[model samples]
Target: MIEDWRQRRAAKRITSGDGRALKRLRWWQLPFRALFYLTLPNGDGRQTEYAVDIPRRIDSEGGKARAHLYLDGRHHAESKLPAAFPVEGGTIEMAISAFGLKRCHYVTTAGAQHRLIPDPRSAEGRRARVEREHPTLSRSISHLSALILLVGVGLNLLQLAEPMSRIPPIAESIGTFESPVRLPIWLNFALAVGAVLGSAERALRLRYGVLDRAGK
Candidate 1:
């Protein structure tokens, strides 16, 4: 029941788009921009292409970014992050995180879900290419990324727990805790940077979870 209400509310947030041609992604924009495409059959049996474009670095004056949806080659609709844009058979769901995109997928009426294809010149596209050309190496790298995030999150939780346990009431109820593993400040900073990169790599593959989101 609650999920249905949330869906209805999201549907209401979608607004029509002005028919503007999408700007080509520039070389400098590769890191800050994300473009995804989905093709589906229209009523007349011709394929209609839909594109979701997000400029991660550019924020509106209100401090929130928007995702633009283009139909064929013209602008179709747009909405804020975590948007649900209605499409031919379902909706295109878009979401972003501090590091990169957390979601860009098509959810179909029959309950199937698929990630949209990334533009060939984008970072995500290069990652996808590696996966295609070196499947084993790609899988190994992905697993390593997950491990890095797990370690980062585990250390963060331990650090948080020690501080929380120091409160007077909490200290009385349970002895103050100390993290067993401690690293130098420089190492900690390095680990933090590594964690961000790992999370970004996972985002390129559309992989996300509580830890990945929290670590970011």
Candidate 2:
């Protein structure tokens, strides 16, 4: 029921495009832009190519991130972040994170989901290549990213608990609490940086979780 509501809400946000040609992904735009493609067969026995283009740093319509949908290279439709653009056989759903895209996929009418193929020159494509060529190393890096986020979440909760426990109402019930592990300011700063990098790395592979999303 909640998913259906979300889809309906997203559907309302889409707007028709002006039919401009989709811009080519430039070398310098790779780090800040994401482009993905999907090909689907039509009832006429022909294939249609759809592309999703996103400029991660750019905002539109009052500071909201936007995504563009292209049909065989021409702009077809657009919507704000967390969008759902209805397509030939399904909907192209997209959402962004502070560091990059958290989600970009095609959800079919029958409920099967497929991630779109990233443009070869983009950061996501590079990460996908690494996974294809070095599965073991890719797995190790993914694991490490998760571990970093977990540690970040744990430390954050511990620090937060100390402050919350100091509140008058809480102190009366639980007494003032002290964090068992307190690191130096420099170490905390380093950990914060690590968390951002870890979250970005996970974003490159389209992996997102609540804890990692907070770090981002």
Candidate 3:
């Protein structure tokens, strides 16, 4: 069984074209090449260091993608890793910086190395999933607020409210605001859309990186 499993995993290869896996496929692809910078309080005034980069995505199972770690352009010795390496669940963390928006993770195990989705949604980020779920009340509120914002924006655009019908005041307000510029037509529409988007974001618990039900 073990040999069969190994053969199956090896067949998929450590990597594919660029993004490796579909989740990773982005406009910008980092080669086996991102560098991580770390400083230790060892304050020998010397910077403690290791080569860290984004984890590799490989097939852990038939056609299933997982992440694995590398260090210093090569994998590093966890044993010798200067006590300074970030540790979590017996695994160290690495981040690829060139792509400001991307994240990476890996684990070293007696069994095969494991890979994971790059963001808060990953199983490692279970807490994030909890936050996204938050509580029913909060989710409801975000949805309701979004709806109200949309309605308000609509009212502004339709000139349905007498006060909003005056363009001069609104134009002046728009010019003065640090927030979104208030255009009677498109601007209001955008705000309404934003309301929905914002609510959706909260609903997804991407806001605080946590999605959990209340009283859970």
Q: Give the best candidate by TM-score.
A: 2
Instruction: Summarize candidate 1's per-residue lDDT along 1-216 as a digit string, tens digits.
Output: 995686787687677989999888777887888988999999897999999998886555546778899999899987777788889999888888887888898999887999999988888888999999999999999998888888887887787788899999999998899988777888778778878988999999988898787786
C-alpha-based local distance difference test score of model 3: 0.37
Off by over 4 Å in 1: none
Give candidate 3's TM-score. Answer: 0.23
Query: What's the TM-score of each model vs. the native?
Result: 0.93, 0.94, 0.23
* Model 2: per-residue Cα lDDT over 113-199, one tens digit each: 999999988889989999999999999999998888788777877887898999999999879999998888887787788888889
What's the distance in Å from true for residue 1, model 2?
3.9
In model 2, where do residues sit more than 4 Å from their true spots? Answer: none
All predictions: root-mean-square deviation over Cα?
Answer: 1.6, 1.5, 17.4
Task: Give the C-alpha miss distance for residue 211 in model 2, angstroms.
Answer: 1.8
Which number leads on lDDT? 2
The lDDT of each candidate is 0.86, 0.88, 0.37
Q: Show where candidate 3 strays beyond 4 Å.
A: 1-36, 41-45, 55-58, 61-73, 77-216
- Measured on C-alpha atoms, candidate 1 has an lDDT of 0.86
User: Per-residue lDDT of 146-179 in model 3, one digit per residue for the tens?
Assistant: 5555565555434444444356878566533233
> In what order do the candidates fall by TM-score, top score first?
2, 1, 3
